[model samples]
Structures are given as C-alpha cells and as structure tokens.
Target: MTPSETKEHSPMQQQAQTFGYRLLKQDGAARLGEVVTPRGIVRTPAFMPVGTVATVKALTFDQVKQAGADIVLANTYHLMLRPGAERVARLGGLHNFMRWDGPILTDSGGFQVMSLSKIRKINEEGVRFASHIDGSRHLLTPERAVEIQCLLGSDIQMQLDECISLPAERKETERAMELSLRWAARAQRAFSDLAKPGQALFGIVQGGVDAELRQRSAEALVAMDLPGYAVGGLAVGEGQELMLRTLDGVLPHLPSHKPRYLMGVGTPSDLIKSVARGVDMFDCVMPTRNGRHGLAFTWNGKVNLRNARHADDPAPLDEQSSCPGARDYSRAYLHHLVRSGEYLGAMLLSWVNTTFYQELMAAMRLAIAEGRFNTWAEETLDRIERTN
Candidate 1:
C-alpha cells in the first residue's frame, strides 16, 4: 500500500494523519495559504530559516520559535555524512535530536552535489562524492536520498534533483533537467514504499534559466502529482530579472492547489517579487548569515553595525520591533559587540533578523488575504530599498 493508504499513523508522526495545503486567499498572482502537516500548520508565503545540521547556527530552538518560524530546514547530505541518518533515527529522529517540535523540511542534498563536495561524479544511479570533512567516499542515489529523509522523519522532504549553475549551454541545462525528472520518479517510488502517512515528498522543477526547459520540467513533474512542487536550479548566480522571467513563464503550469516552494531563494526583494509570482514557501540562510556579519534587516532597510556611524547611535535597531534584540538593545551596544567580535552580537542580531523575516512573511500574508498585496508589495519594496 502507498503511504496515503497506510492504516495507522507512524509512531514518529504524533496526531498528523496526512499532508495537505489549504489556499486561503490570493491577490493577483500572490497567494496566502497554509501547508498542513501532521506536526503543525505552516502559514504562507512562509520563510523557513535554514537549520543546517539540525541547528540554526547561533540561535537556540526557543529563539527560532519565538522569532515566529513555523518550520526549519536541515541538510540531508551533511547529516548523512556526519552523525549519519541512521544515527539520527536511533536518537529518536531529528526533531528529538535537535529539540525542535515544529515541522522540519530536509533538502535532498542535490545542492550539495553541486557545492560542498570537493570532488563528485554524476550518473544514472546517483551522485558519488567525497565527504568534505574526512574525504570518505559515498554514493547518494535518489532511492537512498528518500530513505535518508524518511529516517529523519521530516514533515516535508524534497526530491533529489541535480542543481546546475547558470551560464551553461542549453544542452547541458537540458541534460541536467531531464536527469532530475528521472530522479524525481525514482524518489516518488521510494517515498511511496517507505514514507509514513503524514510525510510528504515534493518534486522539484529544474531547467536552469531556459524558460522552455522550465515549462517542460514543470509539466512533467506536475504530471506525477506529488504532494507539492518546488522550482529549483535558480538563485545560483542568475540575476533577479532572469529568475523572475523564468517564474513568470513556468508557474502557471504548476497546480494551484499544491504548495509551490522556491528553493535556496533570496533577499527581502527576492521574496517579495517571488511572492508576487505566486510562490508559497521559501528557505534561505541570508538573514542569520548576514546577521552573524553584523548586518541587520529592518523595515528601515539594512543596518551595518560594523560601521563607525553607529558607534554612538544610541537608538535601538527598531524600538517599535517586537523582538528584544531589535527593540531593546541600542545600536551602539550592538556595534560594540559586533566590532569586538563578541558571540552575543551574532546571537542577538540573528534573532533580530529572523524575527524581521517572519514579520515580513506575516505582512505578505495579511496583504494577500486583504486583496491589496500588489499595492502593499510596491510600497514595502520601495521602503526596504531606501537603506539605513
């Protein structure tokens, strides 16, 4: 029987019976929706923080939750390499291992095949690569990828797809896209055989920057009718214009009822633009990564705490902000902490930036629900571009 036909909920999935998406509202091409998992509900247009290795770097799980994240993403390739997927499963799954009860999404590690791995080769079966840490050899097939994600007990799991960098020849792009489609089918079969009732495996659309190839990939994946679809292989050196153009061409082919995720996507403006194109979910490391470098994202635009201009600026990042790191601490203090390379600077700024991203998602949801997303997006983008 398929996962959907399973008679009992898996012990790992608590009260969750199945995965679903509910489209609550829309404005133009913008959408407001909820991704329902057995674990919890994720409101869209949602921004999930990257918790690579089951941690969001400097921030604690409580800080992540308090920052308003409904989900966190983990890296499958890294985990399978290090602590190992079996080790995590033996430790009672990633949620138990990491102590985060909210829904978790695990990337199939296709991106790492392009990055991270110092040396690698691709074939019909999967990728064979050396571990970045210890130079150990490992093979990651689509079937093995699905099994690894299943072991983690993630609420949402991505299909293993080969991600290619931009500025490549049409033939090269087409070859990678077709390979990803074949892998998607393999992933689906494995998921059907191994996944629990409440878990979901999403197919990814990969076509580099070629619009026609993108549509071809989307059409084929949509035919599979997976739980969700993700637009992958972008945001890897292609500028904003081509990325948006590709989305404009390909998104309509995807089913409206299923959630649409744009993988490894971008900045505040990128999210706003992608939302306008009807994407439902996103995950990126920009907020926390930039925060660790003393950059804070606020409504007033980017604030670089390393600047001497803020050395005496007694004002908080945003006194009107809800997060203490943003509202309570002065810029002067944060600047001192950051310039001095204090760890608390990373912690507090990470919290502040994370909270800001969640706040942005909440704002987009409200705007989409109220039928004014276009206007709100225009105004918000303008405000965000002005800088600090």
Candidate 2:
C-alpha cells in the first residue's frame, strides 16, 4: 500500500505511543528486529546510506531505494551550511526538499563542527565555529541543534554533543564527556518542549575510547530515556580492534530495547564486527567515496578498476552479483572509463558498491535470523580477505 494509504499519526501522537522494539531473532550477539518509526518501520541490522548533502552523493533517491536502504542519514553540518536548515523547512522539510518520503535520520552537526570546521570553541552554552563553506560564523547549542532538526522535520534527530578526538588525554576526554552529558540534558529538554508527532529524538553517547567514560555517558543518556541511542566518537581514527573494544565497553550500558547506531563507520569487516557486538544501525560514506575512486568491494575481495589486468577483460566485475553494474558491465569497459576519467564509471561503480553493501547487510540480517551469523561472518570475512 502507498504511504498515504498507510495509517498516519501526528509526530506528537507517535512520540506519546509507548516506544517498543522487539528482538525478532539473533545469532550470537547479532540481532534482527524492527524499528517502528512514525514515518514507517525499519528492519534492524539496517544500513543507512550517507546522504550528506541531502543526496546520496552520486545516486538519486530511487537508486538509493533500489540499493535496499530503509533509511538515509543526512549531515546537519552540510545542510545547515548550504541551502540552510531554515530554508529546507521553508521548502517543506528534508523529505519534501529531497523528494524522498522514506525515513531520515539527521545528525546533530556536533561531530562535523568538531572535526570539519575551523576555530571551534566549546563551552557550556554550545559550540561556536566558522562555517566550513564560507567562513561565516554560527553558534550551535543543544537547543539550537534540536530546533534545526525539528525545522527539517526529521523522523530521527540526534542530540548535540561534544565529540572529542581520540589520542586525547584522559582529562580532556573526561571534560568532553561531561560536557556532552550536560548538553544531552539540554537537548532532551528542547526535544521534549518541541515534541511533535511521528518524529523521535536520539541521544549520542560519547567518551572517546575510555571505557569508564563510555559507560558514564551511556548511563547518563539512558537516564534521559530518549527514543534511540547512538555510539559516537569511535570511528574517527582508532583502528578496528580499538573501535570494537570500545563498543564492547559501551554496548552493555545502552538499553537493549532501543536501536543502537554506530556513527561514521566503516569497512565491510567493520560492519560485520559491529553487528556481532549488538549494533543495530550504521551509516558510512566508504562505499560511494571509495567507489568513485575506482575501488569495488566484492565477495571475492576488493577489485581496483585502474589495474591494467582489466584493460581487455570481457567478464563483468562480478558475474554472480545481482547489481547490473557488477553483473553486467565488463571489467574492461569499467577500467577504460575509470582510467579515462568518465563520470559514468563512478556512477556505475557507486551503484554497484551501494548494492553490494545492501546485499551484505541483507545477508547479515538473514544469518542472524537463522542463528548462523557466526559461521556466515567467518566465511564472508575469509572470502573477502582472500588475495590473489
């Protein structure tokens, strides 16, 4: 049935409804479930493609839909910089502005402000920074962050929190964590006051890589009882093992019934490992970004289209694949386009990468549901790690 035909409720009504998340199945710590949002239901173990600038890089909304994404993540930092969040709302919110009626989750812009902007100063009130786009000044507090997301009419909104860079001193991490907790409280208040039907607010747990700090942040955010929770500040520069260890440290503190999102991660191996650690949602730019650079991820391993070996090859990138870019286009053609700097090369490869990523998530969901995720993960990892 069409979305219009489906039952509709005001955002506030949906928020008032007791938020429920049921574990449908599991394989080890990996889980399969559904997140019933006011916009719609999203199958857990879901991978939200990054639509940083209100678009999923090279692909259209329909193409993203075909890639098997149940939700798309937009960057508040980018959107607020250009076009402007207020402008987007005036144009009728992100869904209408982007022409994608499906569910959307918007980051609080804190991460980008910390990592991407220049001269960022953090205080009790909020962060003040020069815009990365035009060097214009802007202030983003917890309340202002919520106000922006509300204006964009996001289905899932994140609270503004400080994300400390790793390799940080213990004292620095503690300071950031404490500040984030205070901001989370302010964000909670803002969200409560602006509560609308169908939309939900999420609080992010931040602590760099310190286990104690992570637990503290999680416990504090949990106290606020947000609809969902996200594990942020992990994938910055820490290696995979460190990130997983951090997840192990933090996951136990988060409520099992609420959806757990791991922000800005990662490689295929990373996704599998995070799922095994009980993470339920993810968003990353690796697939599209790497695809544009001529890298293709496959079950057999990564293939570089710039290699001369594919110059005369007649076989598709992967004949056994379902995506047209992977199963239909000859390697030689892809190589030529990529080497010649043609736009279609990036488009096709990006499409394939997206499809592959979705297929990987689908396989993971099925494996967990069937209680064989461990075996599936091992075999999948072995195949991809194979070289020559």
Candidate 3:
C-alpha cells in the first residue's frame, strides 16, 4: 500500500493523528493485526527486510515491494556515520531519498553500538564510540538517538538503550535494564520535542535472558505507553528455548493494543514460535546474508546451492513458487553461478530468500485469522526447518 508524503501540521494536530494499531483477529496468543501509519498499512506478523543503509542488499526497492513487504528497516548507526542524519533530512528525509513510499523503521543504533563494546565506553549519558568506517568519535545519547531518527523522518523510530550480551551476571543485566529505562524516558522527551506528525517512537525492552528482568523491563516500558515496544537483546547467542521462555515471561506485561516488535530475530521457525507468543513484527539479516552465501529459503526447507548435489539438478529452487527468482531458474544453473562467484547468483538468491520470508508471514497472518495458528505452525515448522 503506497502512502502519501507527510504534511506539515501543528503539534496538537499531529498528536490527534498519531500512529494507530488495530488487532483484527487472534488465535491463542497469535494475532492478525495492522499497524496504521500515515505512510502505509503494515500487515501484522510482518517481516521487514533489513535495509540497513536505506537499501536491502542485492535487491532494489521494486524487488522488495514485489516480495510483498509492507515495510522495510534501516539502521541509524550506519546512516548516521556515512551520509549523516542531518544530510538525509536536508535531502528530504529517508523516504524521499530512498524512494520507498511504504513505511520505514529506523533502529536506534544501540545494538550496533553494543557490538563495538571493545571500542566504546558506556556511561549514564550514553555510549561514546568510534565509527567503524573511519574511527571518527561520536557520542550516542538517548536524546541524540531520538533526534537522529526524527531527522531521518522514520515512521517507526526505536528508543536508544544499552544491550548486553547473553549469559551476563544478574547485576550486569539489571544495571543495563535500569539504564535503558532511564534512557527510554529521555528518548520519549526528545521524541516529543523533535518528532513530526505521523512519526512514532517505540521503546525497546532489554534485560538479557533473565525472565524476571525481562518482566521488569517490559512493565516499565509499558508504563511509558509508547506507540510500540520491541523485545531486544534476543538472538544474541541465547538459545531458542531461553528466548521463547523470556517472551513467555515478558509479553503478558505489554499492552495488547500496541504493536510488539522482536528485534534482530530469527529463522522461519523463530518467527512462527514468536508469533504464537504474541509478537507482531520482526527484522533480521538472515535471509539476504544467507542468500548472498548460496543459501536460499523456500516453502519446503533451506536450499544450499553451493552443495555438489545441486550441480546437475534440473529442478528449479521451487517450481511451485510465485517468485521468478525462485521458480524460473534451475538448481544446476544457480549452483554453477554460485560456484563461479557470479554476482547474479547473489542477486537472484537474495530475491528468492526475501520473497520466501514474506510468504511465510502472509501464511501466518492467514492462519492466525482462521483460528488455526498453533496447529498450522507446528506442522509448517516441522516441514520448513528440515534441510532440503
């Protein structure tokens, strides 16, 4: 669904026309819903392709849109480093610059900052880190993070918070969680000051893998009553079981009406299971990253094109698939291209993998609306998790 450009409005007018979330249906904890934004209608159980630097790797916006994605995610850390947030705003914001009319979400860059812990210092104000690009120094405070996203004109903006690695001490986890809560408050205040009409700021829940800390984090963010909440700090070496268990403990505390986003998660199986636990949105680099390496996702299971078995196979990746990238090319050809290090191989596989992800989300939305998500998820997971 194409959305019109943002129109200038008074703060009171913008507040009256803020972002909305509507739950259309539910089966068990799974939901069929819509995130109503000025940019577009993002279908619930949506998989936003990771457009880290305002573009999905190896695919154009047309290809992404054709893959049935209602929204795409961009990174704050990367853009702020390279093109600069102020530069983007001067160039008519991210949507105009990128030419994607659909809704766009900008990460707060906290996770990327966390990954550079060796080169960064974290304190009450925020993290001071050197840019990976050129080692330029910059301080990323909660207020600054919110300001960057507002400058980028993101429809859905994330709060800046500290994210610790898994298997951390309770004291460490508690410290980071409490710090994130304080940051969330500052982020909200900054968002209030800078965010334009139709722009929304989402708070992220961080507590590592501890359920008690997860609940505490969720509850505090819930009290803030942001437009959306994200379960961050998962899929960072935490096993699937622990991640799911963490969701079990924390999701109940989040308001049902607002959208719940699971950050940087996961496989197809992860999406299905998380949907059963009440997550509404997701973003990850798995599909494109795996695709660029000769792995493609499909309805049946994972397909490794670099494998010798596919070198002479006459079959397409999926003859039943609607995506031409998946349905029109033979496995033998893809195997040759991948083995030969052809760029076309990466491009086609990225397209196939992304389309497959969108298809999975669509199927889940339908099943949730039909009141059979649990049954459907179990059977589908058994099929898709198996290697082809």
Which candidate tops TM-score?
Answer: 1
lDDT tens readout by residue for model 2, 80-145 = 888998999999999999988778999999989988897788899999999987899999999999
Residue pairs of candidate 1 with colliding backbone atoms: 16-38
The local distance difference test score of each candidate is 0.90, 0.85, 0.89
- What's the TM-score of each model vs. the native? 0.96, 0.94, 0.95
Better of 1 and 2 by TM-score: 1
Candidate with more favorable, higher TM-score: 2 or 3: 3
lDDT of 3: 0.89
Error of 1 at 15 (Å): 4.2
**Candidate 3 per-residue lDDT over residues 176-251, each given as its tens digit:** 9999999999999999999888889999998998888888989999898899999999999988999999999889
Off by over 4 Å in 1: 1-15
Candidate 1 lDDT, tens digit per residue, 232-295? 9888888999999999988999999999999988899999999999999999999999999999
